[model samples]
Target: MRCLLVLPLLLAAALAAVPPLLGPTLPPGTELRLLSADLRTLHGAWRVEGRRLLPLSPPLAPKAGQEVQLLLVLPGEKPRAFPGMAERGDVFLPWEKEQVSLLRLLKEVYGLAPPERLWP
Candidate 1:
């Protein structure tokens, strides 16, 4: 009987020692390399205003190896972005009820995408 109680405690400790599933959070102001030219024309990215995408003209031309930062702003919260590019498909944000693709965001939001890749 005493062993059972101790077993639960041991299990709890073991689970606590396990690291979280989510990747490590990136610190603010971390510089990222420009991997795509579409990112340079990010200024042309559109904004979502009640299902309307308003266009903006950006005259930026960032070259390869140019340091850039990507920031994402959600309603009523601070801006945030995660590192590490996904191999394919859209990453689902269950909490936000939205799915997003890093490749798309890089091109649409920052106008950047790898030279060998095509922009949407």
Candidate 2:
């Protein structure tokens, strides 16, 4: 019957209208590393040191004096670095429009649960 066919089509249309459900949530303490820069020319390994963020290692730590730059390879364009001071137990980067969104993305990718508060 035309009504029966229309019913299935309507069901299909309804399903399509719904957005795909997100997968299981990530656990806490998970870390994400955004590429600090293009390392195609440089030679060495770098370690991640923050949540949903990456920081340059001290030149003397392992690969001392190696030239490196942070290049964010996101959709819009190069990644911009948020500048801030490190005090107590947090790295304070300058607040920007994308800062919160970036942090949330990093948390999702890294499987980090929402924190009680931003680091001070």
Candidate 3:
């Protein structure tokens, strides 16, 4: 009888602890390198001058002359394009999502602690 009663409580406690243990909270300034270019056309040498930051969606797709942003583990670190895009000889990030601006995304994605000034 006692074992049955204790089991549910133990299970609940264990489940509650699971989420935090899964991963460290990202820092505010950290960034993730996401891809954002077409890879079907490129065949081989993808290293070229066509790459840019990750795109934004909903309002519009990224295009030339537009400033795309990325969430990177390290700011300004560039990533390689996909096979198709590479064959075309251009670099590109291929993923797109709508959210905060690049600077804020970097902070949230990386799980950086709040700024000193913001702290009480």
lDDT, candidates in the order shown: 0.36, 0.33, 0.29
* Best of the candidates, lDDT: 1
Considering lDDT, where higher is better, how would the candidates rank from best to worst? Answer: 1, 2, 3
RMSD of each: 13.4, 14.0, 14.6
lDDT of 2 by residue, 1-120 (tens): 899889999877854443321223222322222222343432211233333233333221213222233233333334433333322322223334322233333343344433322222
Q: Write the per-residue lDDT of candidate 1 for residues 34-99, one digit (tens) a residue.
A: 222234324123333432323334324433333333334444546554332222222222223343
Show the lowest summed lDDT stretch of 10 residues, model 3. 41-50
Cα lDDT tens digits, model 3, 4-119, are: 99999997785443332112443333333323343222111111112222222212223332333332342244542221111111223232331222223223343333222110
Clashes (backbone N, CA, C under 3 Å), per candidate, total: 7, 4, 27
Alpha-carbon shift of residue 59 in model 1 (angstroms): 4.0
Task: Give me the overall lDDT of model 3.
Answer: 0.29
- Per-residue lDDT of 34 in model 2: 24
Number of the top TM-score candidate = 1
lDDT of 1: 0.36
| RMSD score of candidate 3 (Å) | 14.6
